[model samples]
Each structure stands twice: as C-alpha cells, then as structure tokens.
Target: MTQTVPTPAHLVRQRYRDPQPTEPAQWNEVLRVLHEHRSVRRYLADPVSDDTLRLLISAAQSAPTSSNLQVWSVVAVRDPRRKARLAALAGDQAHILQAPVLLVWTADFARLRQLADDHDAPLEGADYLESSYVGFIDAALAAQNAVVAAESLGLGTVYLGALRNHPENVAAELNLPAQVFAVFGLLVGHPDPAEDARVKPRLPQGAVLHHETYDLAVQRAHVAEYETRIAEFYAEQQLAHSWTERVLNRLGSVASLNGRHRLRASLENHGFRLK
Candidate 1:
C-alpha cells in the first residue's frame, strides 16, 4: 500500500486552516515533524524503553543553553505508583498514569550552588530574577528539543503544565533539592490509535511573526480572522467554546489559575529567591 505523503503546503494549511494556503519555500523531515505535532493524551500500555529515554535526553542536551549554563535536569518516572501519586498532585490527569513514562523537567541551580559551596564562592547572581528566567528558558528549550525528537521517532508526548498546580508537593514527591524547580512534566508513550488525535490549528502567522516593530493594533484583525479559521477545528473536535472565550476563561480571573496564584510563595519555599 502506498502511503500518501503530506506536502509542506498541506501541513501549513492544516496548521493555520488558511483559506488560500501557499506552499513553503523549503521543506524537510524536521519541518514536517514540527508542523504535524499534536498532543497525545491517550496511550497504550507499551513501555518506553530506557534506551529510548536516553536518546531523548541526548537530543534535549543538544539544545542551546543560555550562556551554556545548562541549568536543567530531567527526572524519568516509570514506576506506576509514583506516576499515580504525581497524577494526583497534578489535577489527577489520567494520562499521567496511562503513559509509561513521565519526565519531570527541572530548572536546576542546585548543581551550580553545590559547586559554588565546594569552592567557597558566593553565587549572588543566581539570586537575581534574571537567573530564574534563564533557568526557565533553558528548560523550555531543552524540553522542546526532546519533544521534536520524540515525535520524529513516532512516539507520542504531551506536556503537563498542571504539574505546577502544587509545586511544593511535586518537589517533595520527587525528592528535589533546593534550587531545583520542577518546570513541567512530559508524558511519553505509544499513542493509542483509538484516540484519533488530530493536528490543532494555531493563530495566523501575521498574528505572531513580526518583521520589525510589533503592531498591537493589527492583532485584532488577525485574531478575528483566526476565530473563523479555528472554529472549523473546534467543530471537528466537538468543542463548543470560541478561541477568545477559551483564552478569556483561562486567564480572566485569579481562580482560573487553579492555585497557581501562590506560585511566588511556592518559589520562595523551594529556595528560589526571585529577587
């Protein structure tokens, strides 16, 4: 049986649901994988082997780190019981328990802190808010690299931002040391074909990609266009909410944060002096 190859234009059209889609100037395997990404929540019982996990981490480490500080680490959780506990802490997302592995990515300053303590040196810069941003950014970059690598390998993955809902609990559950903050969780496994997940449409390129100065006023028109395009995507998934309404509901109130409003205090408790 001949497999139908998706051209760059097809993928781009699927991504933005653009009415008049244009073919990409260039295309490659990496671009194809990136454009076809979809979060897989349902998974088979198949286990992700240790060898595969190591490969994913190697890909993650290949990502560019801020100043090469590489202030990131990942904890691979495969134990069913531990995953269950973490699922409980993270809004009880069943996917956490269903997936064979849950990789808890962390912004790690503890390694550098330990090095400084051994050398009897003061690391005052790490106390600054800039350093915190660096750590978070580095972790995100590394995790994205891992995601790309995982998708390229035909494995399914989904990010679990809800891991931050109870930061202290997650830290304790993972036995994390001071200065090592859990950035987020990534569930990796073989996707259940029964789930039938599809590529989620995104905002138009004009809405985000700016050449020079950012134009705030033009965003309204772009977003209006996006609403129409993304409505078809929502309808296919049987979703009733509009994109604007969904985002508004997500951030319109303090209650929408789901206890993340105390993140500052949680960071302080975890020894992150966000100065």
Candidate 2:
C-alpha cells in the first residue's frame, strides 16, 4: 500500500492546530519543510560528514549580521567523550550523545577585541549591554539558519537552551576564550524512526500578530483557544501538560531558572562587560 502524503493545507493546519488554517496563496518545498519541522529528541548514530557540516555553517554565515560585525562563532563537537561532557553540563540530554554532531553556538567578541588591540583603537562600545545583546542576537540568527539548512537536508535538530545552566563549565569544556560565550547547543543527526515525533502546535496568530497597538485583553481569549487546540496534541503525545501551567511553573520563581538567574554574572566572567 502506498503511503499518503500531507498537502500544504494539512501542513499549515498541523502547524497551528487551527480548525481552519489559511491556505497559502503560494507554496513550495521550502514552505513544506518549514511547516513540517519537529524537534527530534531521539536520533540515530549516523555521522554527519564534515562536508555537510561546512555547508550548514556557510548557510549560517549567510544570515544577516548587525552592522556587518559578524559577532558569532560555532564549535562543532564530534568526540563522544566531549559530547558526553557537554551533555552532562546541559541537562544531561541523551540526544546530545546519540547525535553525531553537537554545534556549540557562541556570542564572540574576541576577534574584534584582538583587532582593536593590534591597532590601538578604543573599543569602548563593546563594553555596553547593547553590544552583548547584539552578539547573542547574531548567534541566534545564525544558528536558526543552520537549523533550517539541516532540516532541508533531511537531518534532525534540537536546540538545547539548558546549556546556559552552567555557562562557566560549558565555556571551559569548549576551551572558549574570555571574550566568547556559548549561547546554546544544537544537536544534529539522522532522526530515529521509532521516535515518531510530530510538529508541535503553537499559539494562535491572533495572540501574537498585532495589527497596530497591542491588545492585552484579546490575548487571553487567544490563549484559551490555544489551550483547547493544543490539549489534543498533548493527549496524542501522551503528555500530561497544560500550556498555562507549564508557562507559569517555568517562570514562577528564581529556582525555576535552573541556575540561569546568575546569567549576568556568568556573562561578566566571560568578559562581556554589560555596562
């Protein structure tokens, strides 16, 4: 028997769990890949070749930089021992070990600093909080590009934000310089078929897409609609969760930050003088 394929309409509906998703006026392979994204927690032990990795990095470099500063860098880890060590520091997620490559994306300023020192130029702007944000934003944009590239190539990926749990330790493990900070880790490899991961639902566009001024009152109703639609997805995944409760619990207290509350100090230690 031939397997049935999902149409663009189905994929869009799946993306939002919308009872009636807007049919795209234009559709293509890129749209399909984007709408079908699923973060794979389980991966097969297939090695991602250096050639493929290089292509992904080139795609990442194509991402827009802030004023052409290009303040981001990445460290690719393939050694099982190093990956295991990073996995330990990053919530001990099993996918990091199972995946063939762990890309450590970093907000880097060391290169610029070296250039400034060599030319005896004053780099006072790099000491500001705005500059730190620029570096972090640059790293995130680049990493997202690489994610899209990997997914288009039929590989799987999951972003590990918990890498911030022990920022100092992660920097040490990666041998990152003082002026560089690990923003996050990305696991990339062949997805295990047994996992059967599906595209998770997101909030209704009404809640997020503002027309002009924001409407806080309308957001509650949209959240309610999201809760209702996503509940079905949660049930299908056998997950006992409520979006409201999860959001509240995740930010209820300092403890919920999981050591991330000390992020300012961690950034300073890494030479980011967020003045």
Report the lDDT tens digits of candidate 1 across residue range 31-139: 9999999999999998898899999999999999999999999999999999999999899999999999999999999999999999999999999899999999999
| Model 2: CA > 4 A from native | none
Worst 10 residues of 1 by lDDT: 209-218
Model 2, 1-275: lDDT tens digits are 99999988899999899887777899999888889899999999889999999999999999999999999999999999999999898878888899999999999999999999999999999999999999999999999999999999999999999999999999999899998999998999999999999999999889999997988899999999999999998999998879998899999999999999999999999999999
Q: Listing every candidate in turn, what is its Cα RMSD in Å to the true structure after a full C-alpha superposition? A: 0.9, 0.9
Q: Give the Cα error of residue 35 in candidate 2, in Å.
A: 0.8
Alpha carbon lDDT of residue 16, candidate 1?
Answer: 90
| Candidate 2 TM-score to native | 0.98
Which pairs, if any, clash in model 2? none
Off by over 4 Å in 1: none
lDDT of 1: 0.94
Provide the TM-score for each candidate, comma-separated.
Answer: 0.98, 0.98
